[model samples]
Target chain A: MKKEWPLWEVFIRSQHGLAHKHVGSLHASDAEMAINHARDVYTRRNEGVSIWVVRSADVVASSPDEKAPLFEPANSKVYRHPTFFPMPEEIKHI
Target chain B: MSNDTVQYLLRLGDNALILSHRLSEWCGKGPALEEDMALANTALDLLGQARLWLSYAGELEDAGRDEDALAYRRNDRQFCNLLLVERPNGSYADTMVRQFFFDAWHHLALQGLCRSADERIAGIAAKAIKEVEYHLRRSSDLVVRLGDGTAQSQKMMQRAVDELWTYTGEMFESDGVDEQAVVAGIGFDPVALREPWLSYVREVLSEATLRIPPADAFMQKGGKQGRHTEALSYLLGEMQYLQRAYPGAQW
Candidate 1:
């Protein structure tokens, strides 16, 4: 019996007002241990204000191979470009 | 300014120094690779903290000495770390529980140190406390997991805690040295640090389904005065051997 627990993905916010970004994955018996392991592994520098650990199975990630089709189409949309519109000339400032 | 203050800080420094040295022994011997790295990293943090504290103590005494002099030159009768820390790393469970106990107390003590009257001490404490906080969390997390983990793990952790518990009381007891530091505002009231430490430990133990060992025993003492168990001499001999034998040899 392979009694080992599933792998978990770790994300951490380095400090306040920062988004939690994926750091790495670790194997643990449960969510608590996973977070603990993540802390020891990732936050040794005190580089986190918040952490989010999820079972690796639960995270939905976009495929890198699909990036051109998924994101490239938007690049040709001229209206989406902020340069299309001039900055409003405010009475007080540009 | 006071001789006793120098003594008190040296005690704190020695505890961190020796414990860090003991933890470093687990560098390649940990139960797992990740754990080995974690222990080794924590040991480095403690050694850094010890060097800073010892250097500051030396400065306060104006003894024309520095951190290395104190660390390498100190005799066996001069170290004041608890016997528990000096104990061999018997097992993963043993090391984790021992670290848990000390980290809990360290967190509280560092909190008090943050307000030290000495600017240097306060600055060091402020910086070091953050690292100790993480260490406390790491140790606490393992303690709970192991305590609630399996029958064998629980038994081992419980035994480690029981054996180490007697030494914990001395952490909160103030001696003449502590009294002087407290009066000078350069130290904390160890007794004042007790309640929060107990509550923190109690909370973790309770959640782990472990009972607090009865507090009725005759608490162990004398660690802060360089009077140690039989284990320390052996540990010191190994730890100080290179420096002692080579006398100022450097890499």
Candidate 2:
């Protein structure tokens, strides 16, 4: 059997005041190397300020193909959003 | 023609060019695919920096040559890079140690270059220093983590450091270009750069739980005048192949 590191999924915040979004995955010997690998791979363009790499197996992601039932149902609940309560035109704070 | 300025620029350009060649060798052979891409990217940055510096040097000399002409056409005897950069990438440990050493030196050099009187050189320095600063930080972080982390890593890091430490001296010692640039306020005396560099390196090494190689031994020298090691020839053959073959051909 070939010896190799487990895969890791990397997420990064491109800048301050931004959300951490999935970037890419890399293989590394351990957590530290995973983070280093992510920095080198995903952040070279100065595209990110923060990086988070987790073991690929540790991530629990919802299947993208099931999005209609998993997410569209929530979107159809009009009561879940506050758009119906819109009133004052002068209310600057949305 | 200011011989000192020409020499100074060649030193800077040669350092970047040779190191870029070395780094490019990691394109397919890095420990991981991510590292491979990262190294290749960094190599591009270095090669770009070299082109700018070499072109600038050519202009200052009023020479009809361009960057490619200087980079590919120059004989080994005309190159002036330090020996540390020309050594082969022996292992992951070896490459990292070589990078760590050069990054530290480059940070100091760039810091000085940013203040150069030549506006163009200063601008190039300003642009490149930011990237190089990050390179230094990342390399230093890896050194700390690996040196202090596992027995295998620690042993390899230590061995690499010990083997590479001998070449660290020539980096700070001035030849002729050093003096000229210093006088022109476009240069730094590498001797003056040594103390701060040592302190910075010591702090990082200490935090990494790595001991400084003893100062008792004599230092290796001769890269400034192009007395490169055996590895440089092979590296040059690969790097200069296309340019040397096509003499003046360009896209």
Candidate 3:
């Protein structure tokens, strides 16, 4: 039987002071190989100065079956919205 | 401006150009998608370096030739690249092994050239060394992994090393051009690169669990002086086809 390499999620930080954003995924035999693959796959066009790779299996996600219980009830709470608060002109930056 | 300097630059340029073309052959045929992109990137880097060296060679020759003219117009016999780079890419192991040997020598050569007496040569070397350093790193890392890999990979890598070992000697074969370059302080003696190249290669092969070939083994030569294996002609046939078919054709 043929074995496939593990899938790794790739993240790229385009420049300094910016967060690493998810770019794509690739298959690699190890973490080192994963980083190299990420560089070749996601950052070929001078897209990033830094790269991060994590195993796809390691990422945790909320289940679609639990969507309502996960937080749908919050949709009915209109007060949770911040639209009622007005921003002052003095706080321009915000 | 000297004839010998032009010859020296052509040797450097041809080596990069030929190897870059060989790597480009792997573009859509790499063992993996990531490997394909990496090989293409490496090829592009070498092609860029080839343009720098060839353009300088053309300018020094003052023959009205530019980088494109030199690249597309030259026949195989006019090319002065090492024979190792002209050999066919047999397999993934063969390609990586050839790359590993060449990158090791290339890194050392460029480092010496960075301090060349000629400011232009030094400047080109300074820019090229960064890309070559990364190339050496990637090739060396792959060599280690593949060499120390499963039994099948180990066998294939070892076979590649032995087969390609004979071709490596041409890289350090000093000739009249080399002697003149050394005397003029424009380039270092090719012989001076051998020791450092060997030491680094030895260390890497050791870490990779591969045996080093005999240093004084029967070696091949003549590629530096326009002689090459049959492989180069076929390579040139395809590479120079369009240019030969339609002179001065451009996109």
Q: What are the per-model DockQ values? A: 0.35, 0.57, 0.71
Which candidate, 2 or 3, has the higher DockQ? 3
Model 2: lDDT equals 0.86
Q: How well is candidate 3 docked (DockQ)?
A: 0.71
As for candidate 2, its interface RMSD to one decimal place is 1.9
- Which stretches of candidate 1 lie above 4 Å from their native place? A1-3, A11-23, A43-52, A59-94
Clashing pairs in model 2?
A: none
Candidate 2's C-alpha runs over 4 A off are A1-7, A13-19, A28-36, A45-58, A62-94
Q: Please give the CA lDDT of all the candidate structures.
A: 0.86, 0.86, 0.93
Expressed as tens digits, the lDDT of each residue in B1-251 for candidate 2 is 28789889999999999999999988898876877887887788899999999999998887787888888988777788999999888888788888889999999999998999988989999999988987788789778877897798898989998999998999988877788898888877899888887888888888988888875567888889888777778788888888888877778
- Positional deviation of residue B49's Cα in model 3 after best superposition, in angstroms: 0.7
- Decide which is better by lDDT, 1 or 2: 2
lDDT string for model 3 (B1-251, tens) is 39899999999999999999999999899998889999999999999999999999999999999999999999888999999999999999999999999999999899889989999999999999998988888899999999999999999999999999999998888989999988888887889889998999999999989999999999998888999999999998988899999999989
TM per model? 0.84, 0.85, 0.95
Best by DockQ: 3
Q: Please list all clashing residue pairs in model 1, or write none if there are none.
A: none
Q: Kindly report, for each predicted structure in the order presented, the TM-score of its chain A compared with the true chain A.
A: 0.75, 0.72, 0.82
> CAPRI band of model 1?
acceptable
Candidate 3: give its CA RMSD in angstroms. Answer: 1.7
